[model samples]
Target chain A: MEIITSSKAMQERALQLKKQGYSIGFAPTMGFLHEGHLKLVTQSLQENDVSVMSIFVNPLQFGPNEDFEAYPRDVERDKKLAENAGVNILFLPERTEIYPNEPSFEINVKNRTGVLCGRSRPGHFNGVATILIKLFNIILPDHVYFGMKDAQQVAVVDSLIKDFNFPIELIPVETEREEDGLARSSRNVYLSDEERSQAPHLYKGLQKGSEAIKKGEVNPSSVIHIIENYIKTNTNGKIDYIEILSFPNLDTLEQIHGKIIIALAVKFSKARLIDNIILEIHS
Target chain B: MEIITSSKAMQERALQLKKQGYSIGFAPTMGFLHEGHLKLVTQSLQENDVSVMSIFVNPLQFGPNEDFEAYPRDVERDKKLAENAGVNILFLPERTEIYPNEPSFEINVKNRTGVLCGRSRPGHFNGVATILIKLFNIILPDHVYFGMKDAQQVAVVDSLIKDFNFPIELIPVETEREEDGLARSSRNVYLSDEERSQAPHLYKGLQKGSEAIKKGEVNPSSVIHIIENYIKTNTNGKIDYIEILSFPNLDTLEQIHGKIIIALAVKFSKARLIDNIILEIHS
Candidate 1:
């Protein structure tokens, strides 16, 4: 695998590949690759002639109190995993390479927020949108992949691509879960042993929530209460929020009558984990 | 020339051409054809396999009191001129098409914006950056052209392209002038005959300021005073501002030592005119 550390070199390579008629599929990650991130890479490999993966732990996306400083980094392991997965280019740009100075311009995300994880982390999507713009311009991929475990991020990416007219297709892969149904995430490394044992209940709570919505319990508050009860009984982690809103748009529903998502965030001893399930509704 | 109003169709067409290994050169303008605008189109034609021109009088850039509604536009004349100059695509998207609704996202320009036209028109570069982000993504051009009549705009775009890592090359063409020294602008149409004659003095004043700096006068205020005095004496228009600042970065200089710009804006009775000259200063 070719490792690129310079933004200019990466862009030149992407542009050259583009001129030569090779389709590139990109998966951007924040190092510390897990099975879920590797899945995106493997899928991109299947879809395109060239598969490019980027690992930049962007500080722009993290809030003042969030995990910018403490975010996991195992670059050696990440590089080996990326090489084993057959990534054509593994972009590991230094912080200065990505942001030599404070950014002079920024993209403010104004939609598909106000619910779920977005509600808890202000400026999170804005930072994500900004970094993705820089990456999309640099990578110039034909298609980009995202794991639906970070479903709000996927929705933000959808809006960024559509609204800005980025000529790349988005491939949203389903969430990769553990045997006990815990959504796989790098932040999972921060979980204490006891918290790790209880983490599976977050997904189970979401499943119960989905099941209630699938059946006739239609009031959003009632459905939220059912899941809240499930997690409260099974786990010691604090529920940050459990919201039911229209899918992708994340708009509030008077009564759920279209595609909707039941999503939640829980703050355990040291890590915050989020998960969601999307379902379509019949009139 | 082929004209497209749909953003999606234009992107698809640009992408297809790109896949076929064609280089596209783009020039974005507000309508009202003139020799200056045609210069950009003809230059793009020379530089690339295809030339794409867009006429969008972006409302986002205009302040509430600025002349957005009254911005001069002549589609028929522009179409004929662009066709005569051999443009391959003329994208004329409606305001609603460019902005289907109030934008849920935006690019806020934080630098090179506290001087010249940017100082008077806040959020101007922000809007320009937002729209250009859309256009660059949609057109997928190899090179984009801009006239130096709006030098600050050229500077802003240069930063936008480099900072965002946009793959497109920016070709900053020298300001096209008439038999007289007046910078060609669509806004010149709003000038009364007297104002039309006085507008050339704006350029001439910038010339005098440059000549003084070419000699030993290195103080920014003195150079600005010289230009301001010339404009105040020669024209009926109100001298809005005349500033001498470091080039491109638009930073204030204690004493001009490197590349510098003598920029001015004059508000005529009915029209506002702007002009500038960039100079390389030693010691």
Candidate 2:
């Protein structure tokens, strides 16, 4: 596996591969590879002639108070895991290379970012959208993979590609979870042992929300109440928000109809974990 | 010449041409074609195997108080002008097509946009940056051409392409001038015959500033004063702004040591005119 560091070199490599008539698949990650991230790489490998995985711990995405300074990183371990997971090229750009100076131009995400994780962390989606667009321009992939664990992010990317006319396909893979239904994330490393045990309830709460919709709980408020109550009684974690909104668009619904997502963010002793489930209503 | 109205069709055409190893050169315009705009198209035709011109008339770049509704456009005449200039593809997308709805993501330009025309027209460059990025993604051009008449715009594009890692060359063509030394602009049509003659003074003033720099005037204030006085005396025009700053970065300079620009915008009774001259100061 080739490990490319410089943005210019990586861009040239992607361009060279493109000119050779190879369909490139890309998976952009923030280092600290887990089974969940590997799922995206697996999907990319299956879909394209070449798969490129980028492990850039972008500072732009983290708030001043957030885990930017303490974010986990293990490039040596990640390199081996990526190689085993079939990443043909592993781009690991340094902070200086990605941002020689403060970016003069920025991507301001408007819709689909006001709820869920977006409300908790302002400018987070803007940072994500900005870096992803830079990576898309550099890699010039035919298809880019994203784990649906970050559902709002996937929606933002969809809107970005469509609005800006980026000629790339978005492959949204389903969220990968643990045996206890805890959605795998790098931040899982921050959880204490006791906090880790309670983390599974976040996903379980989403499942209950989904089940509530399936059981003909047509009202969005009542459905949200059920899930909010589930998390409140079952876990010691503090509920940040429990929202039921239209998927992708993320507009508040008068009543649940068509496709909707039940998403939540819970803060345990050490880590904040988020999860969601999409439910489609058939007319 | 092929006229493409649909964004999808234009993207596909660009992709097809790129796959067939044709180098595409792009020129994005807002219709009402003039000699200055055609110069860019001519440069694109000379440089690349295929030349593409897009007449978008982007409303995003126009402020609420700006001349968005009153902005001149002539598609029929522009089509002929583009075809005559050897354009292989002319993309003319309607407002609804370019923007299916309000854009979910916006490109905000920060640097090189706080002076001169940018100060007078805020959010103007953001709109320009956004549409240009969309057009670049759609056209996938090897080279994109812009007129140096809008020197600050060329500077902003330089920073954008560098900051975003856009894999395309920016060809900044010199400003095209009339026999009377007036910079060619579609807005020149709004100028009365007297204003038309006086418009040439803007360029002449910039020329005087450039000559002062050549004559070893290291002081910015003195150089600006020379140009300002020249314009004030030579034409009955209202000075909007007269600034001497670092080239491209547009940063304020204490001492003139490196490459710099003396730029100004002057309003006549009927139209506003702008001009600038870049000078490299040798120690």
Candidate 3:
């Protein structure tokens, strides 16, 4: 496996590989290697001639008050996991490498970012979109993988790719879970023992909400109510938000007879966790 | 040459050619092709295995009060000009085809657009940056060409490409002009006979100002004064603005020790014309 530390080097390698007709599948991560990230790499490996992963903890994507400094990173462990998972290239660029100077333009995301984690962390997805533009150009992948664990991000990226008419295919991998239905995340490590146990109920509440909708619940507020009650009764965590919106678009639903997402966030003692379930409804 | 009106078809053709190792050179333009547009195509054709030209009168770049509806377009004429100029593919997507829906994101350009035409026309470069992002993704060109007649646009595109790290090279073609030194433009047709005769002074004024700077006039205000006097005395048109600033970055100069641009705009009876001259300074 080739580990590239320079963006220019990565781009040059990508250019050469592209000219030689290699189909590259890329998964961009912040690099605390987990089953969630490997799942993307696993699928990427299975689908393309080459699998490329990027591990840059982008400072641009974190707000001024957010966990820019505290974000966990372990490049050596990430490299070993990438190698074990059969990734062909690991791109690990520094902050200066990604942004040699302050940018002159802003790719302001005006949609699909008004709810969930996006609402709480303003300017986050704009930063994501900007970094993705840079990464997309550098990597030049035929297919890019994004996990649905950060479902809003997937939706925002989908809008970006569609709105910009990018030729690359976006492959959204499902959220990897801890078997107890708890979504896998680096933030999961911040959870205390009891908080960890309580966290699974986040997913459990979502399941109940979606199941209720699947059983012909048409009102979004009713589904939201079901979720609110389920979580309140089951978990010790403070509910951050519980919302039902149109999938991908994230627009308020006038009716539930369309593809929708039941998403929620819960604040535990030490960690704030988020999860969602997207469903297609005919009624 | 093939005239593709569908962006999807254009992208598919681009994809096929790229996979087969054909390097594409692209020049995007608004229709009513002039010598300025052809010069870009001429270079593009010379540089790559395939030359792709897009004729899109992007409404996004036009302010609500600006000449969007009055913007000149002649696709049939443009198609002939492109074919005659040896362009391989002519992309002629309709406005609806380009925007199918109103964009949910805004690629706001915050720098290098504070002066010249961008200052008077807010959101113009943002729209330009946005459309270019869309076009770059669709065309996937190895090299993209832009005429330096609209020097501010060239600078903004420079920022966009640098900030996003687009792998495609930006080739800035020299401004094509008439024997009288009037910069070639479709809007030249709108100039009255007297206005036509006086319009070349815009370029002449810029040339004289740049010459003064070359001969060691360090103060930007002094340079502006020289150009303002020359244009006011020589032309019957109204002097809109005369500016001397750092080139490409368009920042106000603290010292005249680097590349700088002397630019101006003139409003005649029926049309507005702009011109500039860039100089490299060492002392």
Candidate 4:
């Protein structure tokens, strides 16, 4: 495995692979590799001749009050985990290298980004779209893997790829979970022991919502209310948002005829945990 | 020459060309090809194995009051001109093809865009940056060409290329002009015969400013006053802005040091015209 820090080097390596007819798969992450990220890497290795994983703690994605400083990053450990997971290249760019100066250019996905996480953390999706574009251009990956943990991010990236007509294929892997059903995330480390015990409630709430919908709860508002009630009763966590949005586009729908993403964000102490489940309902 | 109207078709063709070891040179334009645009196409033909020119009158780049609808476009004439100029592919995507719905993503370059034309036409550079990025990604060109007539645009694009690390090279072709020194533009068609005659004065004013700076006049305010005075006296033109800014970056300089770009925009009776000249002065 080759470990590269410079953007130029990564591009050169990606180009070389392209020239040699090697299909490149990329997984972009903010270090602190969890099983969730490794799942993405594992999928990339299965589908492409070369897999490149980038660990960038994008400062732009974090709001002024967000956990940019405390966001987990362990380079040596991440590199080991990535290599073991069959990643061919580990791209670790410094903050200055990723963002030389204040970024002049921003990529914003309209409408889709103004809700959910986008509402509380303004400019977050713009930052995600911008850095993802930079990563896509730099690595020139044939396939890019994103975890379903960030459901809105997946939707935004999918829209960007289609809108810009980037040749990259977006493969969204299922959310990796702990044995106790808590979604695996680096931020999960921030939860206190008691908060950790209650953290699984977020995903449990999503599952309950999905089950209710599957058992013929078609009213969007009623579904949201049930999920909100579940969170309120089961845990002390503060609900950021409990939304039943149409899958893929994330548009709010009156009736759930197709796949709907039951997504939510909850805050417990210093940790903010987000999770979702896609419900495909027949008319 | 192949004519592709769909983004998917053009990207496929571009990919095929890449696989066959042909480097692509691209000229992105809003049609009604003029001598300036032809110069860019000619350069593209010379520099790469294949030249792809796209004509998209991007709505995003136009202000609410700007002449987006009235922007000159002659597809038949443009096709003949591009074919004659040795263009390999001419991409003419319809409005629906480029903007299916309102565009969600926007690319903005700060500081560089808020001067000259950008100041007058707010969100113009954002539109330009967005479409250019889309074109660059779709065409996957080896070298992209732009005319020096849009001097601030060149700087913004140059900054974008650097900031985004797009693999394509940016080639700034010299400004192409008519015999009387009026920079060739599609918008020139909007000028009445009398307005056309007065159009050359815009260039003349730039020349006067350049000569004054060459003769050791360094204060921007005095230089701008003289240029504005020339335009006001020579033609029925309303001064939009007269700025003597640092070249490339377009920043306002207290004292002219190495190279300065003297740029101005004027509204004639029937058309808006802009011109500039870079003055390299020795200390």
Off by over 4 Å in 2: none
Alpha-carbon deviation at A15 in model 3, angstroms = 1.2
Predicted model with the maximum DockQ:
3
Q: What share of the true interface contacts does candidate 2 keep?
A: 0.89
Candidate with the larger DockQ of 1 and 3: 3
Superposed by TM-score, candidate 4 places the C-alpha of residue B40 at a distance from the truth, in angstroms, of 0.9
The global Cα lDDT (0 to 1) of model 2 is: 0.90
Model 4 misses residue A37 by how many Å? 0.6
TM-score of chain B of each: 0.98, 0.97, 0.97, 0.97
Per-residue lDDT for A262 in model 1? 89
Tell me the DockQ of each model, to 2 decimals.
0.82, 0.86, 0.88, 0.66
Instruction: Indicate whether candidate 3 or candidate 4 has the larger DockQ.
Output: 3
Say which docking band candidate 4 falls in: medium
lDDT digits (tens) for residues B1-283 of candidate 4: 8999998888889888887778999999999998899999888888899999999999989999989988887899999999999889999998888777777777666768778998999999988988887888789998999999899999998988888888778899999999999999888988888888888999998888888888888788888888888888888878899898888988888987788899888887767888889878888
| lDDT for each residue of candidate 2 in B213-238, tens digit (9 for 90 to 100) | 88888888998999889999989999
Winner on DockQ between 2 and 3 is 3
The reply for model 1, stretches above 4 Å from the true place, is none
lDDT of 3: 0.89
TM-score of chain B alone in model 4: 0.97
Task: Tell me the tens digit of each residue's lDDT in model 4 across A1-283.
Answer: 8889999888888877887778999999999999999999999989999999999999888999999999987888888898899889999999888888888777766868777888878999989988988899889999999999899999988989888878889999999999989999999998999899988888888888888888988998888888899999989899999898887888888887698898899998989999999878986
